[model samples]
Target chain A: MAMVEIRDARKVFDGGFEALRGASLDIEEGEILALLGPNGAGKTTLISAICGITQPTSGTIAVGGHDVVKDYRAARNLVGLVPQEVNLEPFEKVWKTVRFSRGLFGRKPDDALLERILRKLSLWEKRGATIKSLSGGMKRRVLIAKALAHDPRVLFLDEPTAGVDVELRRDMWDTVAELKREGVTIILTTHYIEEAEALADRVAVINRGQILLVEDKDALMARMGRKTLRIELDEPVAEIPAGLSDYGLRLEDDGRVLVYDYDTSAERTGIARLMGALAAEGIVVRDVATSQNSLEDIFVGLVHDGQEEEGVA
Target chain B: MNWAAVAAIYRFEMSRFFRTLLQSFISPVISTSLYFVVFGGAIGSRIDQVEGVSYGAFIVPGLVMLTVIMQAISNASFGIYFPKFIGTIYELLSAPINFLEIVMGYVGAAATKALFIGVVILVTSSFFVDLTIQHPLAMVAFLLLTCVSFALLGFIIGIWAGNFEQLQLVPLLVVTPLVFLGGSFYSIEMLPEVWQTITLFNPVLYLISGFRWAFFGLSDVPVGWSLAAIALFTSLCLTAIWWIFRTGWRIRS
Candidate 1:
């Protein structure tokens, strides 16, 4: 069964900012879904609506079969959220903060469980330390531990590694994967396309409060991405010389190299024809390299396409 | 209405407040002592007795009430305001605890702090003036009621405030002025008849008067009337707090 189902959700703030516009999606149990978007794309707003922190302007959201509005307690109990900001009580001991979060879900205090959670996050050594005294990366881990303290079936991590260093980011990603292995469904929003591509089972692209697509990660990568050939010449040329313009070639840095961007979905890339044209233009290529499609490429293409559509509208 | 959540949050919040033991304990004791020294000692030298009690002893209950009110409001407002400042309110809101439980936890902790300070001030004031409680039970009841009511008021203020500046506005500017004008240092009878009638409109006057009556067994107003007014105000403040949490005013979305 789906752990979360958002049906036509919309949020219009008091100042008339429409953060979410009829966003609908289903999150299955035990799946890690990555929400990819730029800033102001409503990722955080959507997560807030799902967690019952904010009421929707219109539409319905249910978590674990409980409506977020009508049965908030049950719904909230089924989900835990690690917000983008570090918000623990600074004066409280680390252990107390995690344990208190569990109790907030109306769960009974279990020392063994709390200790396990702390240990898993590598925070047991500092259980007695105050939150304000912990380091930045440790504080981020504390938030994750707090969210997991209640043992919710689903976890929402909104940019969990936004400002963290590389080493800490990898550690957090590994921990998230481990949690997914333990059957906790995870929904994450990130500006790091590689993080999504590396960790997400499914990728959902959202722009301007609208969802562009949600697809299986591998299939989406295979279907929409493109490849590019970057040709560097021995010498810079003045222009494309008019004859090579039909190959969709872009001249970079006054024709130091010619860039050819082509869809991988096409039958042929016409690399031989392009080379023939470049040779006929008396441009000798010193080095030629091919690049495969990456999540970042698809993201840029989608965003650019979105912008063009908005421009037309 | 989850007692366990309320208890947990209350315990955590209270622990945080007490974590700075020196600041929490010393600040109130020193402040209360200064009030006694400045008001009860310096000002009491010239003022005559009120209702057969020395001016210093007569003002003891009012002074304690003022401390409790100020401490309660400050503690509660800071408790909520700090979380917001650090952006931790998202975790609190996303938690399974309902609005009532969240309010109960923070405000409950604040009330506990105010109660602790109130007791310390009362005990410390005994050193300055020959104060006596004519009705021990009434005194305890008024202290607890005033602490809780003012804590609720502070919780509302914390929610309404978007930033740190706004947090200090109500407590320092609005509430404190009203409290001082409520006759914490002097009886309303000392004022002209018109001002005395106007003082009755200040809610803190009824709270302090009810507490003062419990101490000296005498007041410018009837003891029962003062008690009734405080009780009504407590109920009204509690109802408004409940409504604010229910509607998620300023805290939600």
Candidate 2:
């Protein structure tokens, strides 16, 4: 069975806003799944339903083969959640805060385990300090330590690096990688495309309370990812020549560079034919380079496509 | 039963109570002592006794009931309210524990805190007056029942309230006035015939009268009626709490 299974879950708030509209997904054990979406795209709502913070209006969610609503205790016991907000008791000590989470999950007091987690998150020295006294990054670390205190089988990190600094964000990525290596099933939601690109085995895109696509990160990139070929010219051109007009190339950098976008999966890229046409026109090419599109481009394109579909609907 | 989770919440709340020692422990003691000085000292000299007991001693149970009710309500309300206000309640909601365990932890701690304050006030009252407990067990029972019942009421209020002002609305505007009008400082027998019947309708009167009977073997209402009144009040509070949890009324959304 999958580690986490969500089957056609729906959430309609009291104000008649449908936050989640029949979203379904299955996350395997020992792999990281990154949920990417725009704001209010139901990424957090879907996480909330799985974590039992909010009940779904319809359908079901199960964690570790136990239904989240029917068998909430067992389901909740196996899952840990790190919410996006930094909501800790201001006067609470870091050690007590982490220890309390373990106890809340019906776990016995394990000081050794607690120590290991705090140390792993670099929170050992600050364990004695109050939450309010710590820096923002340290407080975020405390949240991670709390989530790991019970040694849960699956973990959910909702926008974990939303406001974190560059150095701390890198540290968080390392922590998540280490957690995955330890065989924990991790689900993360992020607006930062690079973070998802770096950490996820599979990527799920959500927009407007619906799952747009769920596929292997590499496969998604290979299937839909486009490549750009940049041709740097030895001499500037006022306009595209009559012979090169059929190639649909864009003149950039004050006409010093001609850019062509092509699909990698296409059988004929037309790059060679374009080169011949340039040569027939007697254009000298100083240098040539090809670059693949980053995940950001694909993400933006997907969301934009979703928006256009909504507009058409 | 998720006892570890219960204990975790209980200890966390108790630690906060202890952390604010001056406000939680000392302030109530000092305030109760002042009430004794004003009602028991200044007024006791003018009025010799009520129902053959010294005026100072007669008001002891009433004063303790007053403090216990307020403490129970405020402690439990604040215990739950602060978490909701600060948004730490998400952890509790997402935990493996059920609502029963959540209530046991919060209400148990609130009752314990109120009981402690009640005992302290009783001891402090003895220093100012010649005091004796005719039935110590009954006194303890009354005190315990009052703490638990009022704490349950506070828990409901905490869940119902949307802001700090609404949180304090009940304990201040409703409960405090009822306690005072319920004859906490004087017996209903001293009131006119019509008003005595009116006082009999006040729920807090039964608690105070039963508690006074425990102290001095004297009560404005029959001992059986007092016990019955408290039993009904406790059951009502429990029912309200059960409904709140069942419907996920205010705590879950």
Using lDDT as the measure, which candidate wins?
2
For each candidate in the order shown, give its overall lDDT on alpha carbons: 0.86, 0.92
- Residue-wise C-alpha lDDT for candidate 1, range A1-313, written one tens digit per residue: 5889988999999899999999989899999999998899999999999987788989999999999988888899889899888777777789888888888888898889889888888899999999899999999899999899889899999999989999999989999999999999999999999899989999998887878888999889879877889999999988777888898888897779888988777888788888898889888899998888899888878877988988942
| Residue-level lDDT tens digits of model 2 in A1-313 | 9999989999999899999999999999999999999899999899989998898999989999999999999999999999999989999999999999999999999999999999899989988999999999998889889889899999999999988999999999999999999999999999999999999999999988989899999999999989999999999998999888777889999999999999998999999999999999999999999999988899989999989988942
Off by over 4 Å in 1: A229-290
lDDT of 2 by residue, B45-71 (tens): 888889999998999999999999999
Of candidate 1 chain A, the 10-residue stretch with the lowest lDDT total is A304-313
- CA lDDT for candidate 1: 0.86
Report lDDT (Cα) of residue B1, candidate 2: 98
Root-mean-square deviation per candidate: 3.5, 1.3
Per-candidate iRMS values, in order, are 1.5, 0.8
